[model samples]
Target: MAGAINATDASKRYAVVTGGNKGIGFEICRQLACDGVTVILTARNEHKGTEAVEKLRGLGLSDHVLFHRVDVTDASTLSSLVHFVNTNFGRLDILVNNAGVIGLVANESALKTPEERLLNMMGAISHNYELSAECIEINYYGSKRMTEAFLPLLQQSKSPRIVYVTSGWSKLENIPNEWAKGVLNNVESPPEKLDEVVNKFLEDLKNGSSKEKEWPSRMSAYVVSKAAMNAHARITAHKYPSLQVNCVDPGYVKTDINFNTGKITANEGAQNIVRVALQPEDGPSGLFFDCNKIVAF
Candidate 1:
């Protein structure tokens, strides 16, 4: 069994939040530190990342928060994060995979007001092949890299938890591709199978047969990448029952991902993600939580 676990011992806990410079990710970092957990708030941009740490310091969370620059898509950056965690904290208690991309382009100047954009979330953006690939690489593969790299450090903890901040688009029904849905549905499927499903979507996208292939017509890359993340979450849980691993939809929060067009505040969204992240040792694993309730994949 895991060490006699206690969630309230925040001072003894250490956590890492990816893309933590702003938005929901920043909120996640703040709340975790408020819980007394030491948090590493990582961002791709060094200046922005350090500035965020300073902001937390202003909040008097300076003792609980620090900064690191990590582009999840880059293995070396992740390696550096791994080394820092290993050498200092010696273990990892929680990891929040909150980084993501909208997989589309939009002219914010031309965009309607946030209220209007909220009403037309799907219609507000446009997609192309390059952004499509980048989304998959970062959203899906990036999380995979983080998990694999941190496994050793995580194992050093008495209780390790991973929270995959997926999306409502991750719902299988949102993906029109039935075959790809089946792969995600297969709890017995390996990580390679998830990789295959994502690759298929990319191929269809490049050939312009994505629609004909029944892939998600809108937010194609975002939808597919998140679904893949959800699948890996399930696999990780199954493979390591001693750990708490789960996926969550943090709600549609107004952040940069949506051009600050979402309806909910970042705090509201981070609340749900944090709740799932701080689950106790014996808590359920390999499940998808929407609004803090377990829901279908």
Candidate 2:
């Protein structure tokens, strides 16, 4: 197994982190760059992306960092990212899908809370803010599109890894049995079917009918989206045996996503992600992780 590469050897490695302008993504970029990898910190906003690059530059890591304006939901922008990577690096060693959203009420709603749910309901409530204009478009579909666009570049590398930053909120045990069965049943099911499920979820949320008893109890769009992402990672790993693809929940790090009320620091949250990203060729693939341990899908 190839041990972790030092900064001097990092120039030979290339990595990209989506939504890397701030939070765990930003820290991941810093850690990766510190190890000498040429890291691309991508964000939807060009100004923010550039500013993030400058922050790293201030720390004397500018030589190892680059900024790209990328919104995962925008197909054109994603294509451009692929082109940029291909033109500049020729191959990609790591791709981190760190961008995501929480679109549901994280409150202590009598309707949603379980008898003994372990997560902090108050913390979840505090973190559950309003959705963005493109939260759904970017959170689930955006990550999927990114994987599709970058798969080719990743294939070119001698050893490639894709890490999907997921969440504990996405546990399948919380999903409705019917919907969960439909998605987790077979890998051969059409991809469009997954989209349909998500669409139905949104429709239910919009129509106020999601409160029905049949609906998944913890059916936050964000949770389902991350679950779908994890499922997609499994499918992708099965499809491409050469690539190492896994999903992880970086245990509640304090970031803008949670309004900075998390228990873990951004650096601590990013460690597991970086560990998976830098795994050797024989590392586990198509697995889901909570913190560092592999979790059941």
Candidate 3:
């Protein structure tokens, strides 16, 4: 049996929230610390990470809060994080893969004043945009790398849990094929097969062939990435029946991802994530949740 730390005796559980410097991730760290969990709030920017730690400290949760600089796309940084956790906490109870990007390329022309456009001979860039290469590199591959790097440490815990912050935009219905959808939606399928499906989808995207006939309803890159993540979570749960692994959609929270156009507050979004993280050992695994309720993949 894995070594288990008594939450009461230890005074808190240890957790790591990625991209936790701001928005929903920040709120998640705050809520977990409030619940007496020692949280490592990770961010790519050291200054931002420090500032967030200071803010959490100001809120009187410093004792349970720590900041670590991690760029999920970078392997060395991930190794450093694993080393730090192994040295300090000895075990990780919760991991929230909340780091993500919208992938929408901004139009530089939109930033210029109308008068300036009139004065210049050059035409303004269109408001409509497309996803960037960097977006896929970070949002999709970065999340996968983080999970892979931390899985060993997570296995060291008695009640390890992974909560993937996915989105409704990534539903299987948007995948557009019976076979492809079946491959992803099959919760009982072998991990290798599921991986093959995800790889095919990514390959199609790279070949500029995906979404040509029937495009995904929402942000294409974001949706596909989240779907892959949800599928991967199911595989993890199946592979490690003792561990609780789940994915969830925070339900359109007011965050930078949508340019602050969402309906819910950051705290409300964090509630669902925190709830999943704190689930009991027998709680549901390999499930997709939306605000505590199970939702379709």
Best-matching candidate per TM-score:
1
- TM-score for each model: 0.92, 0.85, 0.84
Runs in model 2 lying further than 4 Å from the true structure: 1-11, 104-133
lDDT of 2 by residue, 1-297 (tens): 111222434238889899999999999999999987889899988888888988998999967888888888788888888887887778888999998766643345543334222244323422222352245567778888989889988998888999999888777776774765568545665667777767776666666676572445443666667767777788888889999999988998988676676799999999989989988779999898888999887
Clashes of 3: 0
Q: Which digits, one per residue and each the tens of the lDDT, describe model 1 over residues 1-297?
A: 011222334249999999999999999999999998888999999988888888988999977888889999999999998988887778899999998886776545655676555435465333588988999999999999999998888888898999999998889998877789888888789789999998998888888788778888777798899999999888899998888999999888888777686779999999999998887767899999997889999
**Which ranking of candidates, highest lDDT first?**
1, 2, 3
Instruction: For model 1, state the Cα shift of residue 10 in Å.
Output: 11
- lDDT score of residue 146 within candidate 3: 82
| Whole-model lDDT values for every prediction | 0.86, 0.77, 0.76
Cα deviation of 25, candidate 1, in Å = 0.5
- Model 3: per-residue lDDT, tens digit, 93-176? 899999998655434465464334332312222111234345556766677788788889888888899999988877887778
**Which of the predicted structures, 1 or 3, would earn the higher TM-score when compared with the native?**
1
Name the better of 1 and 2 by TM-score: 1
Error of 1 at 181 (Å): 1.0
